[model samples]
Target chain A: MLLTALFVIVCVALGAGVGIYTSRDYTASNAVKPAVEGFLWPNPRIIQPFSVVDQHGNPFGLENLTGQWSFMFFGFTHCPDICPITLSLLSQVQKKLAEQDTADKVQIIFVSVDPKRDTPEQVADYVSYFSKNLIGLTGTEEQIAGLARQIGVVYIVNDETAPGDYSVDHSASVFLISPAGQWLGLFSAPHEVDDIINRFNTISEYIKKQE
Target chain B: MRYSSGFLFFILIAVQSVFAQNSIEITDVWINEAPPTVKILAGYFTINNHSDDPVDLVTAHSPSFQKIEFHLTETQDGVARMQKLETISIPAQSDFSFSPGEYHLMLFNPVKTTKAGEMISLQLTFSNGTNIDVEAEVKRSELPPHHHHH
Candidate 1:
């Protein structure tokens, strides 16, 4: 009887050891995801439904963001310095991604905060100057406010005497939206092309591995 | 041979100084090519003071625009805001760089169509009553010749 009890104890110890070892191995192989750089969200924020119009006068919403990554900036075409500069930097980013043959995986979107002045035709023309691949979006005040509010972007129209001589102060950071239309992270202003491309490639590789 | 090369290097440095020894030198001057309907355009440049005395930029006038103001874009707590400045002081033997997202010139009410590759002349008035004329080319791009800071 004592020998049988000893055999049972040995069996229980071996079973527990095997179970713990397998669980650890499973976690190492599957549970861990590669970490991203500064300002990456471990859990992407769910983007709510929004309706707007693209520069081509086509309906654009969260659905448009489906199946591709997007780097979105909020500014107006009238913004001379930062807006064009940011768009130019994004074009460089897109160029690098294109060299890697991953350009189709992502897009650059410029959303106008000054819808009162930035018409569809004007936006289309402005964005096309940057790159044909760049998309421009504008909409009714409410539609724009809803999307900007959800994304935590703020724009204030500065009061000036001259009618089109004013400037709209908006958030300068570029947000990275995931393929599933979730807010993944953001790259702040004073942006560099290499830094943005590197961060994007790292994130893309990690996402591909997860799939 | 090493002594001769060193002398050549000294001569090169002297030549560079001869070109840069002016009291106020403008470099990296550029302006954004505004859209047709937009009245206000932004301009950026850097001013280096090689003279022994400080220079105060008291007034700025651009023939292309009706009025010009020294403006600064300040991002505080993730919000970008611009404020007008009456004057900007440049210390002696120092440099003041006005680039995107920093000090800039806000040109209001363009007198005519300002296209890219066009030149706009600006007359700067110093506190000491010295006037400097700077010509800035209207260009559009995010990446300047120099790398971005931070």
Candidate 2:
């Protein structure tokens, strides 16, 4: 009877060791897996304190970006082709993430380059047409430029002889900001909903593992 | 079924030509509806030249809009910019598609608020003294309403 009991204890110990070893292997494999297809910086870029206003005329700055991951795109409301299209696609991304039950922690911010024309009320109306989850922001040229420069978003207002007959040439890239208010990476133009969601999930998992 | 549909499309084109005397025929006309706060919108369509000679589209007129311009959105070094074109030439038996993110008609200052699902009228004038009137739907940016490509 004692011999049988010893054999049973040995089997149990061996099984437990194997289980632990497999788990260690899994962790090591996951750590080496790539997060997403973004141009991830070697170090997270820190954002400075630049004041802007939200669609509701509330203060929005670097502090507001704390505690949540953000995807920000720089465009104006009057941009007929790219701005509305990008915002609409981001809305689809938000909806898909919500359906997957992962969008509660993510935010999409639309920062307008033409603060002279895009008032808070106008921005509010424009964003509400797409999705309530989107946050619209605009500010004075200097303040907006400060934030734009930090993220490498460029915009130049064209000169037109007729009033309201010009366009603003701006960067068409979507930037990813970490939950700790650091610029994480950037996704280039022609963003797809499925690709964005998968990349976001992968990045989130990777960030959690790193933490 | 495919042959029958193709025949029907040809018949439809014949009928359109009978009415408009087609020097330049436009199909798949659509306009991207602007947000409530925006005053500018863009129109997309395909222009087909049915004549034996080339045709130059000189101007676009829309009574519903204050001004119209032929604009193309081009990206250079990741910067999206708009370039206004003076005219677009359609060669004989050739087609030019004014699609989104490419060549489009920029309609500014809408006389009436244009929402999705509404139709607007546009008149296109050619350098050869030909004009074609077309009606297009204002579509949401996400949903491309029509994709009838040949």
Candidate 3:
């Protein structure tokens, strides 16, 4: 009787130990999923080919975004407040990346929704004020809309009281595109510099693991 | 006794001056300097109403810009839209701030390139029959400090 009781206690202890170890292993493997806020992982949407002109009047398509990570923002030069503020924050992000020697690995793109007013030359001049490394893209209304629709960006040109007087209401989120030209995700408006950098690093690491 | 009397007189004079001047106070006036090609700029400040009644800001004009208008930038569902406000009312004994991404003074067609550190003069008219002059400095936006979580 004494031998049987000792045997039963030993078996139960072994079973509990194995159960705890298996459960911990299960959770450890599941941690591979991207945990960053606002990150679209597992199934980032592949971008279709769409054409727009860059600041230098070069045709920019999905192929142009294939070489490096891209941070894209949609706004016009006429906007005095939010556009500049967002662009400045992006410039700071670019600067911080440069400090980490990862600047060349990433590219910043600004797309103008107000194509009627933001010509390629105008965009060229406007982007230069923010960062020399920044790429400004603008094109016809249809061209702009084609790309915007694919990325789920919405913009509206308010009725103008005069020829040169109006405002373009547009989505203020900053989009992150992978080097493979996939729409990874977006950082919502009122963005902070540290938050963006941290998320970018997280997403980048996750993408590396998948490869 | 003489020192106490003098202090009372000083208090009385201060009270008289407070009543003689406008009941509205302005501070922290500054403008966000934009690129040279950009036609419009944003100006920010804080308004304090010390009076017992609400005050309405009716008109604002600046010699440095061709036109000045009160505009509010409202963000809804990730879309940012700008609306013009004809008058901004400040309740009594409250503080109102005009900051980035919110209510601001839309300065259009600058008379000249306003550089950072330069002062722009503005005149504001209130519904309470008070006219106050303000000078706002042009400044570049600075990145906020990083927040660390323990």
Candidate 4:
């Protein structure tokens, strides 16, 4: 994965260099993926079909993110620490993008791995608590599993001997979808908000230039 | 008279066994590591099993909270993961400490009255149907909800 990630870095760097030359936007410097020493981007996985409803109580399919780069995350609203932290990191990515003043693009989506409990309203409340732009999604158990499987995320709910009294085991990686809604790549766990912001900033420019 | 010494030895063994069977001792208990508003907590302490057999801890009941379960906090790929444990194996004559970011007990949805420095009575049920009640002291620091694995 290290060599593959380095190759990705080279691709992103080359794209950034080209974008800088054409756009002449110095503020977009934030878009350049600043090399984070010791940080390795995990290989992107093929995403499976994910069925979920958006925060607005509307059914949102995977194709909904078409034409835009998305940072997709799987988590539950009830999660206290890690959930907030991940969302905050994604928000930082958005903030950095705005700081760079790059071409208008990017959306962050949060998919609720715990569906039976997280209603649309609950999703909205949870995401809104972090950032208004953050999208919280929920769906039935089967739909959620399909999406999780596609993203290489596995979440298991162990028995606590009672309903609603269980814990879920899930993958920790954040999914990154391309403008065409294809699962492009993913950001692994232990990611810092600034690191994500910087990397996405770099990727955003590449995405815009490809168009 | 010859039977008297044998009787004494058996009595001594019985007395020793009383303290040796599923003896659970607890110290340094607290719940304030994160915050009560967060609705989750991890309690830690040492349990020294003095019995001669394995004790399978299955269930935990608490009067201070709505529900209590055995849980473990593990960080996979730096993502904090929390899960409820179905059974914990406590070997005889050894100690098991339930601490943060490791083996722990998850106490959820405490009532408004439950506060720091309060005593929480949690009963641990074993596979053999023996149960030991432990009194834990809620710490000054709020108990964190999720394990922050790095």
User: TM-score for chain A of every candidate model?
Assistant: 0.81, 0.86, 0.84, 0.73
What is the DockQ ranking, best to worst?
3, 2, 1, 4
By TM-score, the best candidate is: 3
Q: Comparing 1 and 3 by TM-score, which wins?
A: 3
> Fraction of native Cα contacts kept in each candidate?
0.49, 0.66, 0.69, 0.09
Runs in model 4 with CA error above 4 Å?
A1-51, B1-71, B77-107, B112-150
Tens-digit lDDT string for candidate 1 (A20-123)? 99998975675355565544656777789899999989999999998899999999987766787789889888878888866458899999999988888989
Model 3 TM-score relative to the real fold: 0.85
Can you list the residue pairs that collide in candidate 1?
Answer: A85-B142
Give the worst 10-residue stretch by lDDT in candidate 1 chain B.
B141-150
Superior by lDDT: candidate 2 or candidate 3: 3
DockQ of each: 0.37, 0.48, 0.58, 0.10
What tens digits encode model 4's per-residue C-alpha lDDT throughout A77-168? 65543555567667777767777766657888898888987888878876876678888888788888887777666676656646565655
Best by DockQ: 3
lDDT per residue as tens, model 3, A1-45? 999999999999999999999998975675687688778877778
Candidate 2 segments exceeding 4 Å error: A1-27, A33-35, B1-23, B50-52, B143-150
> Model 4's chain B TM-score?
0.74
Give per-model TM-scores: 0.80, 0.83, 0.85, 0.55
Q: Give the chain B TM-score achieved by candidate 1.
A: 0.80
Q: For model 4 chain B, give the 10-residue run with minimal summed lDDT.
A: B141-150
